[model samples]
Target: MKAIVVVGASLAGLRGAEALRQQGFDGTLTMIGAEPHLPYDRPPLSKEVLRGTWEPEQASLVRGDNIDKLELDLRLGRRATSLDTGRRRVELDDGSAVSYDGLLIATGATPRRLPGTDGMEGVHTLRTLDDCLAIRAGLERGPRVAVVGAGFIGAEVAATCRQRGLDVTMIEMLPVPLEPAVGADVGEALAAVHRDEGVDLRLGVGVDAIEGDGRVEAVRLSDGSRVEADLVVVGVGVAPETGWLEGSGVKVDDGVACDARCATSVPGVVAAGDVASWHNRTFDETMRVEHWSNAAEQARAATSTLLAGDGGGDPFESVPFFWSDQYDLKIQSAGRLAGADASRIVSGSLETRRFLKLYGRGGRLVGALAVNEPRRLMVMRRQIRALPDFDEAVAAASDDGSA
Candidate 1:
């Protein structure tokens, strides 16, 4: 390939670009981004950046001599308008285009915005560095914060607000937080984490509207009640940033549909990060993961897949992994914990709020979730990969010293 291009100057994009260079691709490398900043760490934006532990600028993932020596054209603050797969070039919003022999789509995701809430002051969605900075400034005012959606982002934001001594209310349409991702039982267990921290959590309620004269002053709930709030932070979830590929013939089923190798339906165009969905040979299912770890791992896998033929690239097969921090609890999980028919605590107890829960489907170990139990979480990850019987996995996950 003479020229290579990557959309979405994302963390995954940076890693994929570096991997390509490291594999000795001395061609024209171009990185494009909608955001003005370089590829940076986003996991810290909600926690560290909000807590004043790090500045928004400090969240840049590519630091020091990492990307400086790559000699790639870094195109920041420009949106990729359309993809011309036939012409092998990406048209930009500025009416220019970048031609490439190979292209990687890593455009990640955008926070799902609330309906009729656009341009409303104090209405925030935490997706970018600027958003985090604005919210951090909002927190400094100690405003009564109403965080809509009690998923990972909402929970973290509520926790950070509570820590900052702000009046925080976390609302979820579901009966429990993260019910869609981590099942109901484990979700309720973690829900207690929020309650114990003094967060006013409203479960099983949908938002009617954001009410105010000119700024967000309250959130009308479905139950005919309203919570007084000076700010509203929406963390409902994110949708894949695939609008640019609408007519590009790249399969877009919820995301850019790829096979197990991260190769898009259109040849010479592969996708990674939140924008890519594929049948994972590991779990034997088609899924799109929106976690930081998944993005990094998939980018490396996509890079390998992109550099194949002349060089060998391994097919991507990974068990999904992600974690969250809230108050005094360190919640971690790996593998697919949602589809399991049966779940058991192999060691420790949820009553203590520090236990490892193993999930099984068809009597085979499929997933594990742990709270403040890193060692057992690691063991469970290995056992989940082993695909042992329920009894074997239970014994393996036990702290009895041997599997």
Candidate 2:
């Protein structure tokens, strides 16, 4: 391919562009980013940046002389309006079209917003650098904060606000936070952690509306309860950015549907990151991972698939991994945790707030979660890739003196 275009110049897009060059594809590389800035690390936006421990520059993905060496036609602040498979062209919002011999769709996702919260001064979503900055500025006011969602992002923001000694009330519709992803037992344990840190945890409740005249003044719960707030941060989740590919014939379901090799329905076009939903051969399941690690790893794999031409590359098989930092705990997980048949804490205890829990599905050891148990979590992660029997894995863990 003589020319290539990479949409969504964030972590996945930046890494994919770099991989193309590393694989000896020295073509006219054009990177289109909706954001006005260069690709920057996102995980820190919720932690250090929101807490004022790190400046905005610290989140830069490529620093010093690194980005200069990529030789990229970096088009920032420009969104890809649509894609045309017939002409191999991408239409941008700036009234320009770029033809590509190969295309990398890394459009990622946009955060879900609560209705009637738009144009409200104190309502915020943490998805971008600007979003984080606005919330951080609100934090300076020491506002009474109501976080609507118990997901990782919401939890982190609440933890950050608490660290700053702000009154934080976290609302979740589910009785246990992250129960669907990590199981009820583990979710309860996490809830205890937040409570211990002085977070006003409101479970089994949904936000009915944001009550305010012009700025967010309070959150009305579904149970007819009101959480008086000066600022509201919504962390409900995100939806994949696939609207531009509707008529592009890329086969988008929850994301851009790709095969095991990361090749999309259209030849010469592949996807990665939050926007790409590909079949993972290792797990024997189709998934779209929104973690930072998956974005980087899958980008390289998707780029390889693109370079190898149609039906030429090896399958992109990987164990999903993600980490979340809240208070004094670093929660980490590997493989698929959701929809597991069973889970057992093989190390430590929940009362101690440090443990390693193994998850099994269909008689196979499929996932592992760790609370301050990184070493054991990685070992379990590797074992998960081998697809060992759940009972045998648990026995091995006991024999190895994990508990």
Candidate 3:
């Protein structure tokens, strides 16, 4: 390929471009980004940036010398309006078009906004640097913060707020935090950590509305109880940014549908990271993960596939992994947790709020979580990655520390 265009210019886009170059692709590299700034890390926005321990600029993914080495054309602050697969061109909002020999879509995702909260001051969602900065400014006022999701982002925001000495309330429709991902047992165990840190966690309840006259004053729950707050941080996950791909024949369902090799439905095109809903050949399932690590891994795989041409590269297969820090606790998990038929605390007891939990489905080990127990969790995570028998995984996880 003489020309390669990567849309989105976020972590996945940056990593894919770098990997293309690293994998010996001497093509004309071009990147298109809607954001004006270079690709920066998003994980720290809710924690370090909100706590003022780190500056927003410090979250940049690119280093001083790293960006120049890629030698790619950057179309920053340009929104892609549509894609022309036949002509191999991308139509931008500015009425310009960029044609390419190969294309990689890494448009990433945007935080889902709560209904009736749009354009309201003091209500925020953290997705980008600007979003974090706005939330940080909201925190500076020392107001009571009400977070409207119990997922990683919401929990992190609540933790950061509590650590900052702000009265924070975390609301989740699920019965426990991360219940959708980690299951109720592990999620309940972790919720205790937040409660111990002085966070008011409200679970199994829906938000009726975000109430405010001009700015956010309070949030009403489905039970008719109102949480009076000055700041409302909504961390209700994110949706893939794939609206422009409609009618583009790219096959987007929640995200751009890709094969096991990360190749899209449209030939000569592929997708990675948050924008990719790829069928993982390793796990024998289709998944769309929004974690930071998945983006880099999938991007590298897509890059290699790009360089190898059609039907030439290995499929993308990596264990899904992510971590979250809440106060003094470091929570980490790997593999699939939702579809597990059974699970149990393998190493440590949940009474101590520290354990390694293993999950299994249909006799196969599927997932694992470590709560302030890193070493053993690493081993258990490896077991999950290996797709061992449930009985064998249990035996390995119950092994003594010497193992």
Please report the candidate that would top lDDT against the real structure: 2
Measured with C-alpha atoms, the lDDT of residue 198 in candidate 1 is 88
- Lowest summed-lDDT stretch of 10 residues in model 3? 394-403
Give candidate 2's error at residue 154 in angstroms: 0.5
Candidate topping TM-score: 2
Candidate 2 lDDT, 56-132, residue by residue in tens: 99999987877788899999999999999999999999899999999999999999999999999999999999999
lDDT of candidate 3 over 152-255, digit per residue (tens): 88889999999899999999998877776788877887788788889898998999999999899999999889999999988888999999998899998879
Please give the lDDT score for candidate 3.
Answer: 0.88
Candidate 3 stretches with Cα past 4 Å from truth are: 399-402
Worst 10 residues of 2 by lDDT: 394-403
The sequence of per-residue lDDT tens digits that candidate 1 reaches over residues 273-391 is 98899888877889999988889889888877887843345668887888889887788898888778888887777678888888888888888889899877876777677678977
| Candidates' C-alpha lDDT | 0.87, 0.93, 0.88
Sort every candidate by lDDT, greatest first. 2, 3, 1
